[model samples]
Target: MSTQTEHPPAGGGAAGVAEPGQSAAPGATPRQTLTLLTVLLAVFVVPTSISGTAVALPDIGADTHATLVPLQWVVNAFNVAFACFTLAWGSVADIIGRVRAFGLGAGIYAVASLASALASNVIMLDVARALAGVGGAAIFSCGSAILSTVFDGPARGKAFALFGTVAGIGVGIGPSLSGVLVQGVGWRWVFALHTLALGLVLLALPVIARRTTEPRRQGARIDVLGSVLFILAMLLLTTAIVQGSQWGWASAGVLSLFAGTLVALALFAAVEKRRDHPMLDLSVLANGRYLALCLVPVAASFGFVTMLTYLPSYLTAVSGYSSGTAGLIMVLLTLPVFACPMLAAKLVARGVSALTLIYVSLGCLVVGDATLTLFGQNVALMAVAVPMLVTGAGMGLSAGLVDGQALEIVAPEKAGMAAGFLNTLRLGSEAIAVAIYGSLLATVLASRMRDGIGDFPGAGDPATVANEVAGGNMTGPASAVDASARGDFTDFLVRSYDSAFHTILWVLTGICLVLFLIIGALVRTSRDGREPSAATGSQAAG
Candidate 1:
């Protein structure tokens, strides 16, 4: 939205060619090209790290000897930190130069990743991953802002298109590539690889700093109190969701966590309202339509991202696939994401309804989650292929479309604030969705295992064994069962995991349908996802 009205350099001398006088023009083609590639390269790895780490969870658990409850932090920690700090990073980028913020973020990411690779225990690894998430927040939020700052008009569109594509590639291929690395090089290399890629980004920072220009905002502040409150609130809420089933939903600890989350949120809201430069711009959030569009990503988080993070582990445990094979199979579900954003955008541009595409996306998620129930012991791959593709396509279609549509309803100057809020919801929900899914899956698996395992001749504690299996250790605990009954117990573990997965899928279907209804009612967008009585110019309602 920061459309620097500057046109392409008249002579076009290599585009971005610095001249004797005048600041390096933003329309500098060569410089913009370098900036785009560099920023995209940094951002692509963020999603790869998000989707890929799950493939290595089992290995991390096996190596660290941790249970499911503690091990899930490996993913949750990163996501939660990213969600909480993203807005702060954006604000910071406004105060400091974007290039410096980017360099700082890249540095943190590289160091944290290196620390993660060297961690000796699960706790150490979780802390390191959380640090990386903080770094990732800056990279993800600031990268697009950088692109918006550097390129204008047609070139901007192309840059963002590539941005979305590379990110999708990262998400789509994360599981497959990670599985290979885990199998061939050990799990440590997973983080090691992140360190390596980000290091390259860091090395390019010198060139980037000299080439790019961002005017620092005069009076912007980071809103530390608001940031802390929001982060504490999210962490508490996620913790409560993760522990609710295990601690008894009504237990004092669970209730207290929920209560604490509410108090923190109330404080955050109050702080935002009072602050001169709040982390969350309350005025922007008052728009009903914009808020509804933000939820679109939340739906994807629950329906698709949950699957991306956990399905690999599920397949390895219940469907009898190795880590590498499970990752390969996941390609069927994630590949569509790589191509569908552009396809969806073109369709909208061609006069197809944007809301219609959203509905299609939501519908596909519902259908896909429901159809995935077909997966069970020895299930044929062909049977689940359609469901995976449908789900991934749903995710793909909405990729960057929601942000684009959301921007249409806001004043151009407020685009940054709106985007910040949308992404906060996007990533915050992802953290919660994944936490809840894993918790509920383990909860159900525990119940099933408890009901059936006690009857066996020589079984370990059902709760403990279920936790172990959920954390990706299937064989270690099977030793407790009598040799005659070991096979049956292992079979029971597989059946229980499959059953729990099916239950979770159904819940996801219901969530998606409800989201669709809520968004449909809120927008009143015509068949094409635009307002019925839309305004003429570039922006509609705003």
Candidate 2:
């Protein structure tokens, strides 16, 4: 492991030891406050940017005249770039400097946000969003890595809890905030706000206290080939998933994308394993605890974050609510995120095992997804709200506890890489979840609509009807469809949507249940034999 002594500021101590620039004091100096403020701002804003963008998607689509596929690309582009570049940026942070990487990320993010706000077309917006993801990856990796290096022991736990809480609040508030912005100003203002916030942080960056440089490893090189292969694999896989329903699952285009994904992923794994300095250290997978920690987030994010992206769209489209109202209803899904993390942190401090927390979280997720599946349609909004709350709480607890616990098992020098790896799983799962859910929803909706509308009189071309309904544009007037048949079409649209929603929810529930059992088994066996110190209770306090 690499070791380097971190120097404290003239008047401040290192992170977690004392308040910066204060002598064993409980309070922080102005400089320390600025440092914490700067880092926390980035932590909070990145998640905010993601969820806020989700809320703005409807406006973006309407303004840019984007179809469903391009709309999916708007979100997928950002997630793909963020997921692919995070580990590379993490490694680079360790190589160059965390502060420098962070500054660069913030700058890039600001510029990209401005470009997105000014984008004239869907293609430009998508490209800008993808570039912004590059910046987001750097910010996310460096923010957590910096915290891991600065704090230790119980203080590390506390700092991370705060970090998680701030992140949760950002996630919780993003949709509603974006709703207000989009409603009051315009969709453009959403990206503009991100640019403004990041610009302020950039101005304050130089004044923050700087930490000592992390020692660089000798003969270390970034795995450029591995990164390219991983990016190509993820891109191909996501493209296949997103386009499969539209193109036909067995179509040559879809099949080719899947084949390309398999090949790229195989190449990526081989290259990473052979490289002396891989972007991701494959040896970490040998540690069962570490591997479990990495995967729990993947499963959790698949169920949790995916819902956050689509639920508002559902509310607005199927439920006949305005975007602002959908944003308000989304509070049920995000509020617990703000409250549950601190509670989970307290429980962990009181000796609750991280594994136990994870197991319970998965259980909560299963129940939540199942409930949502049952109550998605032909029910009061309250029915959906209850499950959203449950799922949100589960997400909060899992996200709050897992990252800190995952870091505890790794060497401090590799903190950036570990953080990068953990988030890559998270954001990567997010990208896949969105693709799968979107495709499934579209496919099922189209199938049901086609079957139902075939017998309807004067419903115009069945293909056009199916396309419109599947795209959630059921209210649009069509000349081919008789006015008398409109009511039946609306009913069919609702039923199709409800059925699709239930199918997706059921799949997610099954995923949570299976992952819960698998993780439970891993924890039981590990506690019985391997790494008894960690399995017992040594690492749980954090």
Q: Stretches of candidate 2 above 4 Å error?
A: 1-33, 54-74, 118-125, 183-187, 207-209, 212-219, 242-249, 313-323, 376-378, 382-384, 446-451, 458-467, 477-480, 528-542
Q: Which regions of candidate 1 fall more than 4 Å away from where they truly are?
A: 1-28, 53-76, 95-100, 114-128, 149-158, 175-192, 202-218, 239-254, 408-414, 446-454, 460-479, 487-493, 525-542
Of candidate 2, the 10-residue stretch with the lowest lDDT total is 533-542
Number of residue pairs clashing in candidate 2, backbone atoms closer than 3 angstroms, sequence gap of 3 or more or interchain: 2
lDDT by residue for model 2 (1-542), tens: 22344433211223332333223233444544565678788877788887778778999999999987788778777877787688788877766656677888889989999999999999999999999999999988887776665555444555677777888888777867888999999999999999999998898776542432333333567677887887788778767766776787789999999999999988888898888777677765555666677788777776788788778767766777887688788888888778777778778778887667777778788898888874555468876778889998778777757877776666545567777888888877876777677766776666766766776676655555655655567776234467787787677777777777788888988888887877766656555556433211123122
Candidate 1 lDDT over 139-189, as tens digits, reads 876775565555543344445556767888988777678889999999999
> What TM-score quantifies how close candidate 2 is to the native fold?
0.85
TM-score of each: 0.80, 0.85
